[model samples]
Target: MTKYLISFEKGAMDHIPEADWPEVGKAARAVCDEAKDAGVFVFADGLRYDDGDVQHAVVDVDGVVTDGPYPESKELIGGVLIVDVPMREEALRWAAKTAAACRCAQDVRKFIDGPNNA
Candidate 1:
């Protein structure tokens, strides 16, 4: 099975009104339930915009811990789901379902295959 990282971009979610957040939450929950039933879902979730205050930590090259999102961008990673699937097509189908549930667009990408993939 392959693990795909599905992400939702920032701009696509601007339509949501703060007042209607609860309704959105309900929709998300329903989608999650359907995903669970479909057997195509391994895991899924939502996220907030900020990662709190940025902090620098240790780095491997210098034997130190590093802080902040690696390679930061204007749009923060809002949410994600690690899905185990047989093919990209299956993963994308679930991704589309998620996008519909959130009433927003989402980007889906595959996890790099490597020795540590185990």
Candidate 2:
């Protein structure tokens, strides 16, 4: 099985009204449940970015740790979902479902196959 990253940027969800958030949450949860039932779900979560619900940390190669997020990034990933599947097409299909649920575009990419993958 290959692991694929399915993600969305924070800006992509800007158009969703604040009142619809709960319904959106339900839809996204449904997709997660379906994926879990299929035995392909590895992990999934929404990032706590607003109101400093979570703090970001950045470490340099010299071991200097700094509070993040990087000032250079124009958009941050707002959510992440990982699925281990046999093919890229299957991953894309899941991405579609996620995009529909979140009402945003999803960025899908495969993890490189290597010893580090395990």
- The deviation in Å at residue 89 for candidate 1 is 1.3
Candidate 2 residue lDDT tens string, 1-118: 9999999986788899999999999999999999999999999998766676546777889999987776875468899999999999999999999999999999999999988667
Model 1: pairs clashing at backbone N, Cα or C within 3 Å: 57-65, 57-66, 58-64, 58-65, 58-66, 59-64, 59-65
Clashing residue pairs for model 2:
none
Each model's backbone clash number: 7, 0
Name the runs in model 2 displaced over 4 angstroms: 116-118
1-118 in candidate 1: lDDT tens per residue?
Answer: 7888877864567788889878877877787787678675677776654557664333678676766565554466677766778899988887887787788877989988987555
Per-residue lDDT of 23 in model 2: 95
lDDT of each: 0.74, 0.92
Residue 35, candidate 2: C-alpha displacement in angstroms: 0.3
Candidate with best lDDT: 2
